[model samples]
Target: MSQTITQETQTPTVPAAHEAPPRGGKLAGRVAFVTGGTRGIGAAISQALARQGATVASGYAGKTERAQDFLHDLQSAWAGHETEFSIHQGNIGNPEDCRRTIAEVIEKHGRLDILVNNAGITRDRVVSKMSDDDWQQVIDVNLSGAFYLSQAALKHMLERGTGRIVNVSSVIGEMGNIGQANYAASKAGLFGLTKTLAREAAFQLARDGKLDDDTIGVTVNAVTPGYVLTEMVQGVPDKVLDKIKGNIPVHRLARPSEIARVVHFLCADESGFITGQVWGVNGGQDM
Candidate 1:
């Protein structure tokens, strides 16, 4: 006769009430900086981050009146939130101003946990007809500006041993569209910049003297939002937008909040393992 052994399942262990509080918003206690965050997709990103309990500094290159109004709207939206929002005015296209803005955010917040390079302008024109000013202007703001800001923020982040950077690219960049040569070029450059920075940041984090630290790391990613109902995309004639929508598998343009949600997700602590990715927010639009 052989005796059979019975195994009993162990009871699960739960932390006592005094152990630690449950995690709040993924970005609670974090500070985020967003460029061109006064309106449209940028504003949506700022608001979404704030909703996640992150203090946000929104940079805008425009009139004070609009900036003030945007800030007021953001405050209203976050009436009950502990998140704080501050608006900064500067032209990120200028390296000096771009760096200054990042410096100012760190000065005010005492820390910078995330950076969203969401500022961009489209100077759409056929390659043959594009003017020097148009090409250079878009490039300056969309590509060069991102580089300047990222360089400034990386300094603080590397010192702190962790950070998140999200660059806003475009669907046009992947598949060039008609009359968008300069715009496409500027957006396309973001992909390379994002990937390179992600690699550099990862390497630095690994060597940051925190070999056994699980929380010491940096992540850099890019977002390509498809046609969205923003001031930028609304410039397209309704008929043209309709045709474009028809082509989308979702049969509609993306809401700015939808794109913002993805950005916020990428900036969360849970996304630490995700880096050097081009997270597309398009409605299944190819290329």
Candidate 2:
């Protein structure tokens, strides 16, 4: 069904999940760590969290100049709010670097409340042609990087008795695409990691067979975004891109902010019971 807005009502906010309900600022005074958050979808997530009053630690793998520009834009965008932003420039795929990134965030923020594993790279190649290095690189960053960050942040969240872990998966993981064997595999690994880790955390926080509200548990979930208009999609030829859009019922690719909103919602305080699930922000494409 299609609908239109008239003067009687205004259009709803596209990224409604940026709001945290029951309080003036939904995530007021909290802390968030967003990896690969300097551009594209990750940047959107970082900004959304910051707008909701969470001090955001934005992580990026490279490009010092761009990181500075991103930080400036982020700060400028949220100047009205008392949101603090910092850039952690390092390759999260590097285990040691991942530790240092989380350490800096905790040291500055004094505590860590949310971890969004949005750091990922694509080494698209057919299975027969994909090099070992390409496969290894994607897995190392998309999978192990999340593991490393979550392991480091979980320690603090456990001590505080609450936390949120949102890993950015992909629709390709669900419906494997041509020349994306490595990418799909890496993302599928995220979904597996998400569910298993959620259950493990849940069991650790279990009391009398029920999750304790006072000390309930940390939640782990994955978001699968399809054909989002980001740098990653620029390689697709216009003809192919149009074909992809034609396949999607919505007739267009998803916006980065739309995916960010889903990630933001998963990290909200009210989304405790919504763990271990894969929310597809594909605009009716996958369904």
Candidate 3:
């Protein structure tokens, strides 16, 4: 007699061992690369992204001890969340370093979904007093570094047809702070770079037949934060700091986390349509 096959007799289907289990949070399975990610605002941005379930590759130029401490804290805080964190040492000003940083992240994580060009330096001096080296150094690290990293990340992002790039500019770039000419110019350059790259990303994708209504789009944006309470600002004298705060309508310096919030929003997967925009998080300081 032939026996009828039953549902219980069939083998139950199971997820492949190689497949990653589904994770919670908006950025689950996504990877983010943050420059200068061990200190100040950069550190805040790294934490924000990791909290949302993204694997983070934080780049630092120097300060091994600081980066180690940050990595330890991050891993401890994110333990059991299925999130991974890493710190990479590299000078963002070097194109080769920038390219290698991106390559390392891709190799280790298998993908890069977001890029934050947050590494920057300030050579505070008036044009007449600013030495050539000072100007060049600031420009190299602040403006050119962003370009280098963005250029490297763009190739992969475009091919995948999805990505987010957020440039961290400053209010000094817009208002022109005294003794910060080089810094201002470099930051201002980012505005132009951000807008142009935004257009190019879309154009290239369309040309490659990757553009469509249903596709998760690639976007580039800039966030210009006003005076923030970071090490960069803490050095200012109490009287000067008070004066600066008085100018802000909010009457206080911004927390690094506040700036990170804007970045986190811009990098969200749903923020694809919000490209080439300059978000001023200055507590009405600019307007």
Candidate 4:
């Protein structure tokens, strides 16, 4: 099946029952690896997974101190779960690093269950002013990195016969941005990747006879968050922020945890049938 690109316009009104429990232990024995998880949305996703009883190994590029701090904070927050937190420092843009990171995680944890490709970088420039380097860097990290890591993790996931892969896409990837040509292309590509992988996984499960009337396992999905309040957006001018807010029905940027919660759901077994799809967490911006 071909991938479909979705332009997000509004925040989804999740039913009250779907709200994540405050101290629920839903992911009791899962293992997850979140890329660029040292800070921002990535950090929130890592913590959410850990809180739900998943052993999380987060990847970081250059933020050693911050990575350590995140690990410490997660350890304290989930003091009762016996959750294991580890930091894997590697550049996701490098395919070798991507492979090594997953290999290391499997070595330590003995298995891999979930892969979240959340590492991304932006090199904003108008078409006229954008340099080749600017475009290449964004593509390398935002797009290629996810491909590398997903390919690496696929080996393990396909072998294991059950897994979740969530790619962190963006609202701009759907609706073009003024100065984000490269970022938009990369994120758009991620939507395609998510769909293709989902189909492949479904076929593989069917071949293995894992898809029974009562049980259908394995899922792949994407989460496209709207203007989130992270350091990455701190560079936006006040006017730009105001304009973005005006576009959103909620009239506010999303908190990192809001996006994280959606990611957590997509990674859970409950979402096994929800594959080859993109869920937009925008606050009515696209509408």
lDDT (C-alpha, whole model) for all candidates: 0.79, 0.77, 0.81, 0.79
Residues 216-265 of candidate 2 have per-residue lDDT tens digits of: 36999999887776655555577777887888899998877788878878
Error of 2 at 209 (Å): 11
Question: Which clashing pairs does model 2 show?
Answer: none
What residue runs in model 2 are displaced by over 4 Å at the alpha carbon? Answer: 1-24, 207-211, 214-216, 231-237
Runs of candidate 3 exceeding 4 Å displacement = 1-24, 231-234
In candidate 2 the C-alpha lDDT for residue 128 amounts to 93
Where model 4 places Cα greater than 4 Å from the true spot, the runs are: 1-22, 214-216, 231-239
Better candidate by lDDT, 1 or 2: 1
TM-scores for candidates 1 onward, in order: 0.88, 0.87, 0.90, 0.89
Give the distance in Å from residue 35's predicted Cα in candidate 1 to where it truly belongs.
Answer: 0.4
Residue-pair clash count for candidate 3: 0
Displacement of residue 248 (Cα, Å) in model 1 is 1.1
Q: Which of the predicted structures, 3 or 4, would earn the higher TM-score when compared with the native? A: 3
For residues 1-287, could you state the per-residue lDDT of candidate 1 as single tens digits? 00100000011111122222222488989999989886777877877787787998988887778778777766666665576879888887899999899989999999999999998877666789989998999899999999999999998998988899999998878876777787788889999999999999888777766324478378899998877765445345667777778888999888777888899999998888899999887889874
lDDT of 3 by residue, 136-174 (tens): 998998999999999999999999999999999888789
Which residue pairs clash within candidate 3?
A: none
Better candidate by lDDT, 1 or 3 = 3
